[model samples]
Target: MSDPMNVLAPEHRRLRIGDAWRDAASGATFAVEDPATGKTIAEVADADVVDGLAALDAASTAMAEWAATPPRKRSELLTATYRALTERSEEVARLITLEMGKPLAEARGEVAYGAEFFRWFAEEAVRVEGRYSIAPSGGYRILTVPKPVGPCVFVTPWNFPLAMGARKIAPALAAGCTTITKPAGQTPLTMLFLARIMEEVGVPPGVVNVVTTKRSGEVVSALLADGRTRKLSFTGSTEVGRVLLRQAADNVLRTSMELGGNAALIVCADADLDVALDGAMVAKMRNIGESCIAANRIYVEEPVREEFSARFAERMGALSMGHGLDDGVNVGALIDEASVTKIDELVADAVDRGARVLVGGERPDGPGHFYPPTVLVDVPDDARMLKAEIFGPVAPIISFTSDDEVMAKANDTEHGLAGYVFTRDLQRALRFAEGLDTGMLGINRGLISDPSAPFGGVKQSGIGKEGSHEGILEYLDLTYVAIDLPGPARCSGRPACAPAPPGRPTLPTPSRSRR
Candidate 1:
C-alpha cells in the first residue's frame, strides 16, 4: 500500500480568511517537517500581523449574523460537519502522523475521538436553555437567556493536533460565536486540512478562520490586543499561558486555559498488578508522553513497588520504536531536537542524584529525534524530572508505605490536570478520588478524557472547562430580561389592585421562540 501521507494532497496551504485562500501580506512562509525523518514535508503560508488583524476583523463582522442564527440551525451545520469529519477520518489521521509523530493507530483514534466533540456539541447546541421566574411582587417576570460572547481566538498546541483543534473550534461555533484559530507551527497542516473540511461542510467564510504562522507572538498579540475578540482559549505550557494571560488582561478578555500537568499514577497494594501495569503503559507512553495529562509520576505501595517496577522495565525494554507509519511500531519521535535534549537532561540529572535506570534512557542511534522508552527508580524529589512536567517517554517510579503519604506526594505539584489511582478497595478509591486536588481523576483507568466529560484543571493548571455542557457555557454570556405586566391589577402602589385568589390563578406560558 502507498503511504497515506504521500497519497493525499491538500487543496490550500495558505491562510483561510473570509471566503478565500490567500497568502500572508508579507509573503512569508514556514516549512513543516516530519518529526520521524526531520524532513520538510510541506511549506505553509505564514500569516503576518496584517493577516492576523484581518482574520479578527472578519470574525467580528460575522459574529452578529452567527449569533442570530437559530440554535437548531447551528446544530444542523455541526451534524453535517461531524459526518464529513467521520468520512475523511483516515486521511486526517495520516495527516496527523505526517505532521506530528504519533503511531498511525493512535492518530486514527484521535480523529474518531475528535469527531465525537462535534457530534456531542451538535446535540448540546439545541439543548442550551435559560431560566424564567416570577418576580416577588407578582407584577413582572424575569427571564435569563444565554447569548454568544462574540468573536473568539483559539490558540492550540501541536500534540493531538486534530483533536485539540476540534475540541475548541466545535464548541465555539456551536455557541454561535465566530473564531480565528492559531495552530502551532510544528503541526499546522492537519488544522489547515480541517479548515478545508469546514469550508466544504458549508460553514460560512468568516465563521471559521485559520491562521498559521511562524510569527506566533506577533499574531497572538495582535488578536489579544483587539477589543473585538471577547474570548481567548489556549492549550499549551503554563509559561506561555502566563504570557497570554498578561496580554489578555489588556482587554479583560474571557480566557479558558488547558495548560501543563504533572499527573500521578498511584498503585495501591491491593490493586490488580496486571491491570495496573497495563494502565501504567497506556498512561505514561501514549503520544510518546507528550500529553499534558500523561502520567508523569508513579507512586506504588511498598508491597508491590519492586514487582511492578521490574515488570514495567521489561515491558518498556521490549517495545519497538520507529516511524509512526511503520507497522508494529509502539513509540515515535519527540516534537523536535529541543525536546530530545530536555528529556536527556532530566534523565541524566535523576541518575546523578542516586536514581537507577532499569531500562532504556539514552537517545537512540538514528536519523530522527528518537529516544528509547526509559524507566527509572529511586528518583529523588529534588530531581528536575520529579519537579517539572516531563513531556517524554520516561517513567519514574517512587515507593510509598501508605495512602496518606502517596496522596501528599501526588498533590505536591502546582498542576492538577489529571491523576490515576489503581485499587480494588471501594472505600479507599472513593477516599483518594475525593481527596486528590486534580480536576479529573481516573480510578483503575488510564484514559480519562472524553467528549461527554468536562476536561480542565484547577489552580495553575487552567481556568475553565472544555468538552462538556459547561464547556459551551464558557463561550456564552448570560443576560437577564424583566417584563412588566400591564393592567390596573398589575399596576404598583394602587389600592384597587389586590392580590389574586391563591387557589388557582392562570399564569401566562412562556414563549419558546428564539429572540
Candidate 2:
C-alpha cells in the first residue's frame, strides 16, 4: 500500500493553471496545518491576485472549445474521474481527516459522497435537454437551448472539503462550463490533490483550474470582476457570502451562495424518545457539529424536555475524542484555535444567561483545537448562540409549551436552511414540515444530504440549489430561438420574385444550435 503521508509530496503541493504546475508568480506560499495536532503538515503555493487572474484567463481561453465538446465525451470524462477518485479513496480520505479534522471514518464517508457527485453528474450530462414548442403568435416556432454559463468561479469551505468541491465542480463540468476553483486556505490540499486526479483522468487543459491563497479577499475580488467570468459559487459564512454577493453584483454575475444557518431541531410531545435521541446525535454531532444543517437550537415540548435532554446529554458525554487518525475516535478538532475561541464564548454566554451545562462545556487542554461534547439546558432565547451558527458539538435544549410559539421563534432568524422534527404523529409532523421556514426538513431522519437531492436553503441561507438537477442549472443559461414560417407561395410578381433573389427571405433552412 502507498504511504498515507504521500499527500504531502512536493509534487502535490502547487498551483494548477492550464496544464502546468508551478508556484505563485510572487513565490509566496502558506503553511497547511493538521487541525488535530495544530502542526504544519505541508507548505502549499499561496496564490495571489496574479495567480488568480492567470487561472481565470486559462479558463476563459478554454471555455468555448470545452463547451463545444460533445456531451457524451464530457460524460465519459466525468465517469473516468469518478472511478479514479473512488479507486484512491483511502488516500484522499486521509488528507481530509488530516487537514479538515473530521474522524477518519467520517472522512471516508465524505470521500464516497464527494466521488458520487462525479458519478451522478455523469448521468446528468446526457440528460441536459431543450424543448420545442409552438409560439402563441401564428407562423412562428419556439425552441429553448441550454448553454454553458461560461467561465465560473467556485470558492469552497473547509468543512466537508472533498464533498463541497465535488458538489460544485462536478455539475459545472457536466454542464460544459470551464471553471477555476479556489478551495478554502485551511483545507486546500484536498482540492489540490483532486486537481492531480483530474489531469490524470484526461480532463482537457484549462477546463478545470485550482488555486489556493491566504489573500482570499483580494484573489476572489479579482475573479468576480473579470468580464469573461459568468458565474460565482461560494460556500461559507453569511458575512463573507454577503461580501461576495456585492462583488458579484458589480459584474451582474450569476451566483450560488450556500451560506450559514442556525437550524432548529424540534422534539414534539408525541415523539418517541428513543428515536429522537438517536436522530439528535447524528444531527448535532456530525462533523463535530460543524455543519450548516446541524441543529443549533433544539426545542422540546414541555412534557418530554427532561427525558430527551438526559438521554441526549448522556450520548454527547460518552463520545470518544482524539486525533482523527486514531481508531475509535468519534469526534475531531475544530478547524483552528479561532473556532475553539468562538465555541468557548458561546457556551460562556449561555451559562451567564441562566443556562445550565449538563455535561462537558470546557475546551480540552491540548495541542489540538478540540472541544468536548456539551449539552446545555434551560437555554434562554436571549442567548447569542441561538441566533447564529454554533459550529461545534454543543447542544442547547429549550422547552416550549405550544407549537405556534415554537414555530414563530424558530422562524424568527434570517436563516432558512434545514430543520429537524421528531414526531410520531402524522398530522403534527405534516404541519411542521410545511410550516417550518427552511428549505429542507427532516421529519424523522437526521442526515439530510443525498447525492441526488437538491441541497440548498432559502432566504439569507442561500441563493440557489447545489445537488440533483438544480445543481447543474447554476452553471447553465437558456436561450430562446424563434423561426417565422413563410407566407403562402406567391410566384405572381413577374421577374421581381426572381426566386426571391439571393438577398430576399426564402424557404428557411433548419439551423440547429450546436448546443
Candidate 3:
C-alpha cells in the first residue's frame, strides 16, 4: 500500500492560529520530506516574525480566560483531547513516520505514549490543590495556592515529535496556561493535526496556537521580547537550550528545558545476559537511536565483555533495516543527510582511534538518509563518539574493570540525563544507582521514561522536569495568602497582646528601618 502521508492536501498543512488555518506572512512555504524515501511529503506554511507575534497575541488573549476556567472544566477538555488523539492514533503515527523516519510500529507507539500524557494530566488537573495552614499564634491562616504562570511558548524538537510536544503541551494546558507551540519545522504536520483536534474537541478559541518556521531564531526572539509569554518550555539540543536560556534571561521567563543526553548503559558481570542484551538493544536503537535518553555509551564488565559484545553485534547485524513504511523494518533512516554525515564522521573518528567495528558502521549507499545499526568495541577515551552526543544508530562499547571505574566513566560527560545498570546484586545496583550522576536511573531495565514519573536531567542536560505531578507545577505559580483574624485584646501598657510561652524562646521584635 502507498504511504498515507503522500496524499496530504495543501490545506491540511498550513499554520494553525487559534481556530483558523492561515498562510505565512511572506507567503513562503517549506517542504517537509519523508526521510525514509527522500520524497517531499508536504509543504507547510513557513511562519515568520509577524505570524509568531500573532500566535503570541492569541495565546496572551486566551491566557486570562483559560486560567480562570475551573479545574474540572479544564480536566474535561483535556480528557476530550485525549480521546480525540486516541481515535486518530494511526493517522498521526503514520504522519510521524513519514516526516521523521522511525519505524511505523515505533511511530504508532509514540502516538499512544504521546496521548497518555494528555490522559494522565487530565486527571492531574482537578487534583491541583492548595494548602491551608493555621498559625501557631492562633489568629491568622496561610493558604498557598497554585495559579497558571500565564501564556507559554513551547519549542519542541523533531525527535519523538508527537511525544515531546505532548509532554510540554499537556502539562501547560492542564495547569490552565494558554500555549503557543513552535514545533520543529521538520515535524510540524503532526502538531498541526493535534491543533485541529484541540479545536474540534471544544478547546476554546485562542487557547492553543501552533506556528512552524524555518527562521526559528527570529520567531523565538519576537516571542521572548513581546513580554506576554511568561514561560518557555523547550526540548532540543543542549547547545540550543543554552542559547534559549540566554535569550530568556532578558525577560526572566520561566523555563523548563529538556535538552540533550548521553545516557550510559552499564552491564555488570553477574547480569542476566538475555535481559541485558534486550534492554541494551531497545535503549540504544529505539527511534533509530535519535532519543535524548537513548543509551549512548555501553560499559560492560571485563569478565563478560567478550560474550556480551559478540552477542550484541550478532543481534544488531541480524536486525532488518529499510524505509519506515516497509513491513518488518527494525530501523529506519536518519532524519536528514546531515545526521548521516555526522554519524559517519563520528564512527570514522572512533575507528581511527583504535575502535573496532563489530557489525555496522558506514552509511548505506541509497536514496534515503539511511545508516545501519552499528556496534563498536575498544572505543578510545578521546573518540568523538565518546565525548559527543551520537544521535544515531551507533552503539559504542567500553570495558571496565571495577565498579568505581565504571561509575567514574559513566559520569564523565557533561550530560546527566539518564543511565542504565544491569545487575542482579541488590546492593551493587543500589550503590551504582546512587553513585551515577544522572537525574534518572534504570537499575535493571532499559527504559526510564513514563507518564507517571518525572522526566528530566541534570548538569548541562536540562533545567527542570517534565511529566509526573511535578510537571504541572512547572507551569504554575505558588501564591501565598495570609488571612488575619481578630485577636485577643492587648494589655494596656504592652505593645501587643501575645507573650512568650513557658518553655519557648521569645520572638525577636521586628525593627523598623529608618528612611
Model 2's alpha-carbon lDDT is 0.92
Question: What is the per-residue lDDT of model 1 for residues 135-162, given as tens digits with 9 covering 90 to 100?
Answer: 7777778899999899999999999898
Global lDDT of each candidate: 0.91, 0.92, 0.90
Off by over 4 Å in 3: 6-9, 486-515
Q: Give, for candidate 3, the lowest lDDT window spanning 10 residues.
A: 486-495
Candidate 2 per-residue lDDT over residues 132-212, each given as its tens digit? 866665577778999999999999999988899999999999999999999999999999889999998999999989998
C-alpha TM-score for every candidate: 0.93, 0.93, 0.93
- Clash pairs, candidate 2, are none
Ranking by lDDT: 2, 1, 3
lDDT of 3: 0.90
Lowest lDDT 10-mer window, candidate 1? Answer: 1-10
Model 1 steric clash pairs: none
